[model samples]
Target: MSDTPLLDQLESGPWPSFVKDLKRVAARKPAAKDLLKQLDRSYKDKITHWKHGGIVGVLGYGSGIIGRYSDLPDEFPGVEHFHTIRVNQPSGWFYTTQALRDLCDIWDRHGSSILNVHGSTGDMIFLGTTTDELEPTFAELTAKGWDLGGSGSAMRTPSCCVGKARCEYSCYDTMDFCYEMTQEFQFDMHRPSFPYKFKIKCSGCPNDCVAAVARADLSVIGVWKDDIRIDQAAVAAYHAGEIKPRGGGSPYAKLDVKADVTDLCPTACMSFDGKKLAIDNKNCNHCMHCISLMPQALRVGTDTGATLLLGSHAPILEGAQMSWVIVPFTEMEPPYDNIKELIANIHEWWSENGKNRERVGELMLRLGMRNFFKSVGLEPPSQTVRTPRANPFFFWHAEDFEAEAAGRKYIKI
Candidate 1:
């Protein structure tokens, strides 16, 4: 592993990767070095499939990742198995030196040396672990005050911004909520009782560093119902290009950066009254478009929390859709019962009727919003599920209107 050319190739890049991290272990462990070489060679040979085992469980009450590899004998080597394990991370990512070293020590003892600190998805992914080592490794991890995260078809590990715990922009306690939700959905996570995977994401403010938009099956984003707090000093700094906005969304549109703010302001929220920034609450979408570009000047107010959105399906199911705010904005309570119940209801409904490969959003579409609401016992809100496929093309009103409209239409037949 010490002499592996791939390690040198990887080290030349911008930053370190899991492969590079594993090289440290590879230096001492011949098995790790052999594994890396095998992987490198496999890539060169265009090896596609990796095979492994089943019934893998993690330690404690609620922690572990379970996977089933594609059992195509002709396509894969007998030793190559495609499986991942979830190592629970420290809250707020505040890791002690001792704790960190202890974790690596245990991994060396039981599983593979490679560690994915965090890729786009939130879990601390451990690649290439055997099925037999699963339970014992989990036991050791939990014994050392760590557990597992979501893997397989279960609900994925929920993540949040480094909230009030670290970040100043945090309006709500995002960390507590993330941990609470993890505990709340333990059964749903450890047990594969759903049609497909579920994911949840929370952020301190609109500055969604976690990429909740594309990743989560359900997104809980923070917003303020009140006006943007204008810090004149901060705005001046931003206009001078000394500061940047904290939230996600259209950044250039805010702080009159586009130069069109003097004309038809996109949100009509910003108007320059002789070098002074004015915000109109009614037209604002709470997108933080302005706040982002001019961070010092525009800040989300104290009277703020989160909005729940749905319709996030992976590429396999369909393109991700933005779900409407069913429960518009709720207080971030300790237990988070309201949000938990809503999530549970959705899971229950999906589990009962969804086909093997069907996504929650697809199921909602197929069953109709009216029926979905009825079954869930949720009152239909203003935002109905957008029926992309079901539309006027296949819809007819009553008996005569369709025929009359068709007859009146200019047809060459």
Candidate 2:
């Protein structure tokens, strides 16, 4: 009974998809039914009827509503006043089953029973609500310990991986840090007073389980300053029990390290004799690949900290960019004022000079790193390495060069 034969096949897959759920909802809800019909029409015509609603928000709030409107209002009256609500997610996305059920119940009562678990900015996306219900819905949700996430030009929800709580590889408390930041920046999160939406994401370690390094405006990645802890006995046990050689003449067999942990080190910082393994602490990048392979044999270093990367974003005005190392290391401890100061400085600088709707990464691209560093009052460190450094020429400030020439050391901030 549907023209979308190929789209229907998507419902038959082993995994459950939102499409199937939407279709099911469509069977009961008139708005959902119209939405499906409109979507189908849009697909066939290669166009959409939805348009952005200018300056839409809840009472006393200037951000957090992406307005959805149907141009074919007469044909799809049910979808005429549809809007999306982005609710800030809990740190590490850890929600009790009861909490989720309660949230679903709330949405079912106030709006269409459609939801997106996590939006691109790490918010719990509640789809399909009218303008009239917005304030009441927000009030009820706030009463129940829920808050709206950021939209337009404001600090978005800070997301993090489940560190220390579950993963042994975690070098820091990512969830706690994320929660701290969310609470501390409440004013910034609720207000739309920035050049563009800013996102912060935390990873337990450089494994980047949440893809923070590639997508976040500011990325906090856990790291260690000292050598990885290794248990020689456990290493030997693992080697004896799990390490095996491929008998057949396979290409991979020739290059396999077998149980030798030294050969598995991508940086070649490790060396193994017949009985023991030695690692060059200075050379280890803390990739955790070797540790992942032999978890029982090795652990993270004692002096744990975080590496801050900046200016990562998806394709927009300037294009997609992977965040670059800004602060190579910062001690992540209680009352993280240093990180807060750094965030404030970055935001202030960007808000002053950035164009409307321009992301931090785009501004960085437009204005060189040197200018950004100067504005933020940070000296370019030796560790700073930009991607695609094809043309090796770099501009040095005359004052800095003179100071260096005079044998006066420039202190890094």
Candidate 3:
């Protein structure tokens, strides 16, 4: 039935794989069949038939569609004008069964049946559509309360964890914040006016369920400033094995307080007293390990806000980066102007100075973090710490050295 024996063997596994599903689809869909043939040919020849078609998109929108063309158009006629459509997903990726069915019904009518639930940037990626189908497809989707996500040099879709709705460790309402931002920054999402793509991701707590600090250009992580609230009776119960942990595990059965929580603390701020556990809140870094281990005994502090981390991105020019602390804490109330203004300022600075195709993190690395702060009119806070380094590579500034030579106090910038 198939010429590609090795490719066919990939379908033998018990677990469902995309390759198997593609083969199944190929049996019924001409496009899929051609696609499989082309794939086999490419594997045999050690090459591909895909090529980029420069800058094709729907009317009024400058981004979102990634144009792809097949070189073997005669052989793969159905895939000749294949294009990708990015559908903006709801915050936390929560969807009802009816909503999913509705989305599938709309897509089934428009283009190829292939779909990617959450692409790299967390958008609902619809694969393989044609240029002629773009407008009508977009219109129908919009009529059904769906819209295109961002691409190219625009702000991509914002993602978040199901905060207060599902996670007990959530410090703030991440889902609501994500929705609010998506609605507010509609223009930024649809328009391409930046040096490169910008992305935002929010995590409910420092557990960082969504990996926001490592992935997003701008990251908002929920945090607590005050002391962790301790239920002394619950702490006693946990120690005595009278109750279970939050997720139905035997309480303190496998817990080694010295190894798990206290030793693991970055600042060594936790200590278990004879009667109850106590934490040195001053030294606590707001790492969520203790809260995760003892959910019943510990809850987040009342003074909750979001920490803003800036310039995180996957490697392109510089390297993979974890976001640096920009604003350590900012109130995240409804009508989040404080957060919006900060983002706007960062965008303005990056747009004015960034080179073509350079990410925000790469720009910061090239221009120096000091210049970035000064350009954006932000004072460097004491909380700003460098990413962990294995090697020491520190250099004193010329001005600071000059001041030191002159026997005056060299105040660092």
Candidate with the greatest lDDT versus the true structure: 3
lDDT of 3 by residue, 1-413 (tens): 66566567667888777778877776756666667777777887789888875677888887678898889999888788789899999888998998888888777777777789989788899888788888888898888888889988899989998898998778789999998888877898898899999999999889999999999999899998888999988777766666565546544464555566677888888887656688999999888878887788889898998898988887765578899898888888988877887788889999999999888888988998788887877778767756556438766778877888888785456
In order, what lDDT does every prediction score? 0.67, 0.82, 0.83
TM agreement with the true structure for every prediction:
0.79, 0.90, 0.90
Clashing pairs in 3: none
Could you give candidate 2's per-residue lDDT for residues 220-256 as a string of tens digits? 9999998899888766655565432222222332222
* Number of clashes recorded per candidate: 5, 0, 0
lDDT of 1 at 396: 41
Report how far residue 172 has shifted in candidate 3, in Å: 2.2
For 80-189, candidate 1 gives per-residue lDDT tens digits of: 44356777665456678897788777777766666677744576667655667777777888798776776656787788778888766676888898889888887777
Instruction: Determine which window of 10 residues in candidate 2 has minimal summed lDDT.
Output: 247-256
Question: Which parts of model 1 have CA positions greater than 4 angstroms off?
Answer: 1-24, 58-63, 67-83, 240-266, 383-413
Q: Report the Cα lDDT for residue 256, model 2.
A: 24
Off by over 4 Å in 2: 2-6, 12-17, 242-261, 316-318, 387-396, 401-406, 409-413
Error of 3 at 118 (Å): 0.8
